[model samples]
Target: MVKITNKEAICIAVLFLLGSNIVIGSGMDVQNDNWIAGIFGFAYFVPFAFMYARIQALHGGKDLPEIANHLFGRVFGFIITAVYTWYSLHVGALVLRNFGEFVKITTLTETPLLVIMLSFSVIIIAAARLGIEVMGRLSTYALPLVVLILVFMEAMSVSQMNFDFVKPVFVHGFQKIARAGFSAFTFPFGESVIFLGILYSLKKRESAYRIYMTGMVISGIILVTLTLMNIFILGPVEGDFYFPSHSSFSRIRLGDFLQRMEGTISVSYAITCFIKASVCLFVACKGIASVFGLSDYRFITIQTGLIMTYLAFILYKNTVEMENWVINVYKYYAIPFQIVIPLLIWIRAEFKNRKGKRPKKSEELEINGGEQEEAGNEF
Candidate 1:
């Protein structure tokens, strides 16, 4: 197995969470209430950051299932793994479907949804097969380009920005803005909880927390800044339109030479979505492998990819329905597995540590602590 450095782990985690779907989805809410949403996003990270640090501290090198079984019994461990696996696949499908719809509406109006799904799924499978190191390296290369494009887009729109749009921002009352902020925090920031699986592969524990916190802060800043820019350039009335970033890009006209820069934003979004999907796919496969006692993870990627594709098709009948589902269902359904399960694991770990307990002797003998060891053997 390839050991990941703390910096590499952080980069992958950041890119995985700050991808196109998150930025676009969260950016929409921020446009409505920039300051409030931004603060909410920042606040959402507090609990997650603590849980993540505690998990790593308790079991830095172990996978989720192992950690679960270490703290809970074998049955509970398998249940937790199953829940996380389901969440990963469901989220992956949601992202894939969302991106496909965005492309159909904005760029590839004539392309078949199946073709779009297949193309993206094939790329994700290939990336997972190559292993997590390649994903990290790929993100390292792609992230800077994405950031540069965003910076340019923001800079070009500066001249047209009307600070008056954000004036008297609280005129809508703090409660409405606060609600929007909570929605923003839960989706993009809280979603970072998924990174715990991959992050344990990091070599340096100290750097893990620093990179995670830094990435969270940076992502929050970018999101809030983009929200403010969208509101300033497009005005609140126009900003409320679907895909405000796309709309903002469409309005860019630099001396008639640099017009219709929406494609730039589209390209960046597509790349980010690709990386995010790949990361989710990897984690799902890894979780399943851990649960099923598999030695080779690549074997499950294609099967899981097919399952994800089907799930994507079933997730939403149409774009509007998908957006509604995301706003309503995702928050409640995802939080228990994503945030609550991990919190439980952390608490269990702390309790065990305080009482000075370890796994039974038979459990340690069965797996010998090998990375690929199964929970049944360990328990």
Candidate 2:
């Protein structure tokens, strides 16, 4: 099996977290306190991150579907695996649509969304054909550049930023803060659950916890920074814009030289979203292959990518529905797949592993006793 180091895994996870987040607000409902909401969200995801990492660490070096099937029976495993694959496929489509929308709305107004998605799909399919190791390498190179762009953009826009915009903090009260935390957790942060499929290919199984924790911490910091920047630049109306970061950056004006710097945000989104989409497709294809007993998943990569492109085109009527669904429904909708299944799997893995190890421990004790008795007799 192809193996990726924990470093590469962390890179992939960071980019994945930042992908849709660059264009989407984390806690838009709370307006100026979005960064606080982001903090709460990260805190909420920490324990589950450990759970996810521990499960992957325990069952490392195997594909997720294979692990599931072994832990559960073939039929039940197939069912759970299918659930995860579908989540990846559907989210990949959502990521694709987000990319298309950003490009279409921000740059190519006349260009067709389908064409834009198709173009992005071509690259994702290429990455899939190349393999996970290549994907990791690409992420390693791309993440630094993408992050640098974010820093540069934030720096450039700093001159125009108004610190008072985020004033009157926490006026929304604890319930609202907690609600925003829940929303943020379910999205960009909690979605880390999907990394189990990717983490199984890690070079060092023990690094799974480090990868998840480090990835989330890095991405969480970047996200909180971006969230604060958006609120600082856009004020209470920050939540009004569908793409808050882009909107805030677009307002930058450096004596007409570097005006409308939002293009850099587009470039950033394209790079990270591409990585996210590639990972999703990789996980989905791999799961499908494991289920059907296929020898390789690369055979279906192109077909799956194209299907994702098509779904991207049809998933929502416009950005308004996308926003509504994201803010209103997505958090609750994702609970079963993101929270319930992973929790069940982790609990089962702990139980089965402990129960399965008891026999080995007892057997070892018996063998040691026999060896000691033999030594006593000889002496």
lDDT of 1 at 134: 88
- Candidate 1: stretches off by over 4 Å: 21-23, 27-31, 357-379
**lDDT of candidate 2 over 1-379, digit per residue (tens):** 7898878888999999987998787635988888899999999999989988888888978667977997998999999999999898888998999888888998899999898999989999999788889989998999999889998988888888999998898989988898889988988877777787888788888899998889999999999999999888888888899899989888999896779888888888889899989988988898888878889999999888888888889999999988987899989989998889989999999999999877687799999999999999999
Give lDDT: candidate 2, residue 191: 78
Ten-residue region with minimum lDDT total, candidate 1: 21-30
Best by lDDT: 2
**CA lDDT of each prediction against the hidden true structure:** 0.75, 0.88
After aligning candidate 1 to the native by TM-score, how far in Å is the CA of 361 from where it should be?
A: 18
In candidate 2, stretches whose alpha carbon ends up further than 4 angstroms from where it belongs are 360-379
